[model samples]
Target: MAVTLRPEIAALPPYRQGRAADAAAFKLSSNENPRPTHPAILAAIAESHLNRYPEGAATALRTRLAERAGVSIDEVHVGAGSSSILYQLVQAAAGPGDEVVYAWRSFEAYPLMVTVAGATSVQVPNLPGGHHDLDAMAAAITDRTRVVVVCTPNNPTSTSVTAAQFSAFMAKVPATVLVILDEAYYEFDVDPQRVDGLTEIANYPNLVVLRTFSKAFGLAGLRVGWVVGASYILDAARSAAIPLAVTEPAQRSALTALDIETELLAGVDELIERRARVFAGLTAAGWTVPEPHGNFVWFAAGDQTSAVAEVLEEDGIIGRVFAGEGIRISIGEEGSVDPLLGSAARVVQTLPKAGENARLG
Candidate 1:
C-alpha cells in the first residue's frame, strides 16, 4: 500500500519557514521587517486595478528596478520572490547527477530546492567562526557541480563572506558554473568589507545576484523579488518561472515601495541601530550571541540551545531554534527590543551558567 513518490523529494526534508505563534506572541522568528509597509506602498497596492492581467514580462517593474539597480531593463528579471526565483533557477539549471554546492548552515533553501530539481546537494561546511569557508566550498566544486549559492551575511549565523574571499572562490570556479549571490538581507548589513554582488557582476558573467522586497522592503506578503544576471541567464530564469506569476498588486506594491525607499531605508537604519543594541545587550548578558550583520542576532548556547528554545516558547517569544547551537532573534522596533531582551534574560536568568544541548527536531 505504498505510494511511489519521486526519490529526490522523498529523501529530502521539508523546508521549515519561520512563523509567528498567536497574536499574543512577538513574531521575531521570521527575519522580516517588524514595521508595516510604507504608506505609499500600501496606497499603490490598494489602488491597483486588478481586472486585467499583470504585465506578462513585468516590464514596468523591471524598468523601475533597472533604474534603481543601475542596470538596464534587460539586466533585471523580476520574479515572485527570491524563493520563487531560486526554485526556478534550480528547475532551469539543475538535474539528476548534477551538483549544487553551498555552505551547510547557509540558507536552508539551497539543499531543499536543489534536491527538488533532482540534483545532488553538496554541503560545504562553515568555517571556524561560522562563516562560509570559501576556499573549501570552491574546492568542493567538481565537474558535476553546476551551480553555487552564496548567502552573504548568512542566515541564522549572520556571518558574511567578504568580496575578496569570494572573488578568489569565483576565480577557482569554472567560468561555466553559475554563482547565485543571495542578498535577501543586504540593506541592514553594514559591514564595510561585505561583498556587494552588484560590484562583482561586471567581473563574472556567470554571476547572478538575487534581491527581494520581503526583508528590507516589507513586502513579504506581496511576494516581490528579482535577479540580476547576464541577459541570457536572466531570460532563462524568467522562462522557467510560472507564467503570469507576478500579479498587478505585486508590481505596483514593489514600485510603491521604491517610491518611499528613502523612508524605508530610515527604518532599516533604525533596525541597524537596534541590531547593534541587541548584539551588545546579549553580549553583556553573558550570552554568546554572534555579531550578525543582518536584522537578527544568533544565540549559540552550545548544549543549552534546546532549553532556551523551550523557555522562549513558554514565554511566547518564538525564535528559530537550530540544531543544538544557534537560535535566531530578529531585530524589530526600538520599543520591541526590551521585551525580546527580557524574554532572553528570563531564560538566561535561570540557567546555571552552562550551555544547553537543544535542537529543532
Candidate 2:
C-alpha cells in the first residue's frame, strides 16, 4: 500500500513555472532580466571556494544588505531566493488552523507555501484594474490570521499598490499579525507613487520586506535574495530556513552585484524604457494593458488566453499564459519588441474583446 500523506498535500498541484522557449523563440515567459550578467559578478562567482560548506548564517552578505537597507545586521536575512524567504517566513509565522491572507491571482507560490505550512489560505481577488483591493484584504483578516502578504507590482499583473493605499491598509491590520511585502521586482518599479517598502518598514513593527537579485541584477541563475524586518521576526525565519542553502557562489555573486549596482541599474533603466515601449505599443495596437510598473505587461485575454498565446508562439514570442484569465509578456530583448507587438496586434484584430473594449470579470 502507498504511504499515507496529508490529503491537502496530496491534492495540491506542483508549482508551475513560466514556459521555456526553444531556439529561435524569445523566452519572455519568465520575468528575467534580459541583460547578460555583469563580468564582475561572473568573476566573483568564479572565486567562490567549493571545498567547504558555505557560512550557515550568511554573515558577510547579510552585513552588506543590512548596511544598504539601513537595518541592523540581525534584521537582514538571506535565502536561496526571495521565494525561499517567503516560504521560510510563512512557515515561521503560521501553521495548522491559522490563516495566511494575500491577494488572489498574485504570486503562484503563495498558496502552495501556505498549504505546505499546513495553514489556511485567505485570497482576496484583485480589482478589475488588476490592483489589490486592500480594503477587502484587510476585512478578510480574522483572529486566526497570522500572516498577510502584500505583493507590489503583483506577479502576472504588474500593477502596484500606491503608498497612500498601503498606509491605509496597514492601519486596519492587527499589530500582532505579521505582514510580508514581496518586492521581488523592486528595482524595476518606475512609478513615483508606488509603495516604497524600504521607507515604510520603519513605520510598522510587524512588517517585513522581501527583495531579490533575480530581476534587475541579472542574477536569477545565482538564486540569492534577502528580507529586512525586526530582528526577532527575521530570527524566526532564519530558524526555519534550510541551513547554508545560500551557496557560496550565490553569496559571492550577490556581493559583487551590490558592488556594481550602478552599472546594473543602468541596464534596468533600459528595461524600463523597453517596458514603456511595450506598454505604448500594446495600447496603440488596441490592447488594454494595465500600466506595467514591473518588467512585464499583462493582457487580460479572458477565455482567449490560450489562443492568443498560441499566436504569440507562432511569431517566436513565448509569454506566460493563464488559461481563461490572461497573459503576462515580459519585456525582453530589443529584437523581441516588433514580434511581440505584431503578435499582440494580430490578437487584437482577431478578438476585439481581448483589447480596449474588453470587460474584465
What TM-score against the true fold does each predicted structure earn? Answer: 0.94, 0.98
Overlapping backbone residue pairs in candidate 2 total 0
State the displacement of the C-alpha of residue 296, model 2, in Å, after optimal TM-score superposition: 0.3
Question: Which tens-of-lDDT digit does each residue in 305-354 have in candidate 2?
Answer: 88888888999999998888888899999999999999889988887766
lDDT of 1 by residue, 1-361 (tens): 9999997688778988887678767777888888876778778888888898898798988998787778888999888889999998877888999999999787777888888888999998887556888888899999998899999888878887787888788889999898999999988778888899988888899899999999888998889989888888887788788999989999998888877788888988988988888877766656665567888887766677777777877777788877656678788666667777776777767864433321111
Weakest 10 consecutive residues of candidate 1 by summed lDDT: 352-361
For each candidate, what is the lDDT? 0.82, 0.91
Candidate 1: pairs in clash: 303-356, 303-357, 304-355, 304-356, 304-357, 305-356, 306-358
Error of 2 at 35 (Å): 0.7
Error of 2 at 146 (Å): 0.6
